[model samples]
Target: MLVVQPRSRTVVVLAAGEGKRMKSDLPKVLHPLLGRTLVGHVLAAASAAAAEQTLVVVGHRAEQVTAHLSEIAPAALPVLQAEQHGTGHAVRLAMAAAPDATGTVVVLNGDVPLLRPETVAELIAAHESAGAAATVLTAEVADPTGLGRIVRDAVGGLERIVEERDASTEQRRIREINAGIYAFDAVRLRDALGKLTTDNDQGEEYLTDAVGLLAAAGAPVGVHVADDVTETLGCNDRVELARLRRLLADRVNEGWMRAGVSILDPATTWIDVTVDVGRDAVIDQNTQLRGATTVGAGASVGPDVTLIDTSVGPAATVLRSHAVRARVGAGASVGPYAYLRPDADLAERAKVGTFVEVKNSQLGAGAKVPHLSYVGDATIGARANIGAATIFVNYDGVRKSRTTVGEAAFVGCDSSLIAPVEIGAGAYVGAGSAVTKDVPPGALAVTRASQRVVEGWVQSRRAGTPAAEAARRAAADGEAAHHHDASGTVPGDTATD
Candidate 1:
C-alpha cells in the first residue's frame, strides 16, 4: 500500500494579542497550560505536523515571549507585530518573515493549545486536494457569540465570512463559525492579504475578510469543520485557561492509560506532557507527575505522591512521598511520608521509610533508613541499617560535610552521626550515642554516660516519723491483699481492717 505524504507547509502562529481580558501583565500566549505555555503547545503541534518552517508574531511582552521561544522552540522564527491592528496584520507580518514558497501556509492562534496535530494535517490535505486558494477551519459551536459566522451559497458552496458585528440577524443565528485557523496557498494568501482593507465596523483588518476576497476573485475557498469544537477553543481569560489546562491533562492521562498504565482515578491524576510511564505501572489517585518524570513498569506510585523530574525503576513503590530530581532503583520502597530531594539516590531494594528525608545522599542496595531519620550528604553501603530517630548531622555553622557508613553497619536508635565521620564495616553504634569520630571495623562505639546508682535517695527525702510509719503500714497491707488475691480469695471474704 502506498502512503501519500502531506505537502510541505509553513505555519504562522499569531501570538501578539495583549489579551487584556485576562487582566494579567503576562502575555496571554505565555500563560501555562498543562506543562508548557499556550504558545508552546501550538508550536509543538506545528512541529508535529511536520511544517517546514514556523514563524511566531509577537508584540505584547515580545521580549519575554521571544526569550522563552528561544529556550523551548529555537527553530521557530519570531516576527514583531508592533501595532495591534488585527489578525490579518499579524499574519501579514509573519508572512513577511516566512520564506517565499508555493506550498501551503497554515495560520494558527497561539492561545488555542488544544488544537491537535492531526487536525492541522487534515486541513492541509484538504486544501491541497481540493486545489482551493484557501481553506478555513470551521466549527458548529453551541453559542456563536462574538465569533465570525461562515456563510454558504445556495448549493452549500464556499461563500464569504462575516464577523459578528457586521452580520445580519439571520447570519448571527448561524451556528457554524470561523475557528480562527486557516490554510492557504502561499501565493494566493499573499495576494488576498494585500487586498484586505480596514473598512469593517471596528475599522480593523479582519483575516476573515481575506477569505471573502479570495472567493470574490473567482478562487475556490474550502471549509473544513473540526470534529471537536473544543479543539478550536481559545483562551481569552483565566477561566478558559483553566479549562484548557484540564482538557490537556485529560488528554495526557488518556494517552498513558492506552499505553497499558493503570490510572486508578484519572480525574485526580495530573501528569504533565513531559512525563513517561511504563506499562503496568499503577498510579493511584491524586498523583502528580511533572517535569520529565519517568515511572518504570510495575511501579506503584501514590495515593498521594508528587514526583518532579524523578526516575522510578521497575517494581518500585513510592507511597505518599514527594521526590524532586531523585532516583529510586528497582524494588526500592519509599514513604508513607518521605521527601527525597535533588541528588538523592536509592539503590535496589533499599527502604526510605515513614517520615524520612534524604538529600544529596546515596543508599546502597538493601540499605534501610526505616523511620524518623534525616540522611543528608551521606553514603550508606549495602545492608547498612539506619535505626529510628537517627540523624546524620552533616551541617556545621559555615559548611556542610558528609557522613559515610560502611557495609553491614548498624546505626542504633536515637543516635547522631556527626559529619566528617565514618563507621567501618560491621561496626555497631549503641542506642542514644553521639559519635563525632570514626569507628574501626567490628567495633562498638558508645558515647552515652555510664549508669549511676543513688541508693535510698527517695526514702531519705520523704522520711518522717508519723508519715513514714503510715506509708510502711500501707505497703504491708497492699502486700497482704496481693497474696490473698493470688490465692483466689474474695476481697469481701477477707477481714477489712
Candidate 2:
C-alpha cells in the first residue's frame, strides 16, 4: 500500500541525554522495552512516518549509541554530541548533519517510545498550516511537577514556555505542560538554534528559550495540545520506565483485544508492534509475542512462552516453548518445554514433547518428537512414532547431514538414527539401537549384541540373599511333599509319568 505522508520533513531524534537519573553508563535511549531499544521504537515510528531524513544525536557513550543506531536504522545520520549538553544544543548538533534544505523539521525525544506516526504527522501539519516559526506539542498533565509549562498570550496563542525552576507563580498554575516535542520550518528552526544561549540557571542551552526568541521576533509560535498525554512521556529513570512500560503495553494490548484477539491477562501479556495475531487467537498470561510473529486463528499460546519471528497455523497449541523464527502448522501441539530454533517446521498435528529441541528440520504430519529428544537437520515422515529418548544425530563436527524417517516407522526407545541414514516405511528400530545405516521397509533393525550369560555367576552372587535363605528352608521342610496339586492327583500323575 502506498502510504501518504509528509516525507519532505527531516526528523531530528534527540537521543543524547545523559539520563543521570537512570544511573547507568548506557545512554537512556539505548534501554530496551520488550525486546527493542527505546530509540529503536522512535526510529521505527519515524520511518513509518516517512521522514525524508532522520538524524540521531548521541552524547553519552557516543560511539556505542552510534553503532547501535547504525545497525538499527542504516539510513540514519549519526551526529556526535561529545559533551553533555541541553536538549537544544543536542538538537543543534544534529541539525549540522542535516543537508541544506527548506522543509518541515520535527524534533523527537528518543525516550518517548510510544508515539504513533499519525500523531507525528499531525504535529507537522499543524506547524505548516499555522505558518509558524515553531510549534510545540503540549498536553495537560494532572501533576506538572517536573515538566515545563506552556505560557500563552492573552489570546491563547503560545507566547513562551517556562521551565519549572524559571516559571513564576502564575505560570506554575497553568495545566498545559510542554511535551518537549516540536516541529518548525527548517530555516526558522535553524535561525532559532543559532540564537539559543546557555544563559539559564544551569548554564545549559534550553530549547524552551527558543519559544520566547521566536515570539519576540514577531514569528508565529504555535501551541499544540496532544490528545494522548501518555504517548508524550519521556523516561528519566527505572521507575518512570516501568510506569511508561505499563502504559505503552496496556494501550497496545487493549487495541489487540478490541480487534478480536483474546488476551487472557493483559497485565501479564506482552506484545510488540510488529506482531499480528488472527481472530480467535488466545494469548495466555506471561506470553510475549515479539518481532513480526503471526499467530493464526484458534491458536492458543502459552502462559509462559516467547515466540520471535515465528508463524503459528490455525488450531495450534504452543505451551511453555521458546520458538524463534520457526513455523508450526495447523493442529500441531508443542511442548511444555520445547525449543524450536530457526528453520524448524512442524507439520499438521505434529507433537513436540517436553525438553525436545528441533532445529533446521521438518516434522511431517502426525509425526511425534516425544520427550527428551533433539532432532536437528532432519526430516521426520508422516505418522512416525519417535520413541522416548530418540535423537537424529545429524552432525559430524565439520558438516551437518540430513536424516529422514519414513511413514509410520517406530524408532524404539533410547535409539539414535544417525544422519545420512533413513528408516523405511513401517520399519522397527530396536530399543537402545544406534542405526548408522538405512533400514529397509518392514524390517527390524536391531543394533545391539545378542544376549549372553556367564556360567555359575548366579550361584556365586545369590548365596546369601533372602531367596537363598528361603530355598534352604524349603529344602529342609521336604518341599517335594509341600508341592501338592489342588485337590486332584495331577502333580503325582505328572511326576510318576
Candidates in order: C-alpha RMSD to true structure: 4.5, 4.4
| Predicted candidate 1 versus true structure: per-residue lDDT over 328-348, tens digit per residue | 999999999999999999999
Clashing residue pairs in candidate 2 are none
lDDT of each: 0.91, 0.86
State candidate 1's TM-score. Answer: 0.90
Candidate 1 C-alpha error for residue 189, in Å: 1.1
lDDT of 2 at 96: 80
Candidate 2 residue lDDT tens string, 31-95:
88865789998887666446788888888888899899878898888888888668889878877
Q: How does residue 325 of candidate 2 score in lDDT?
A: 97
RMSD of 2: 4.4
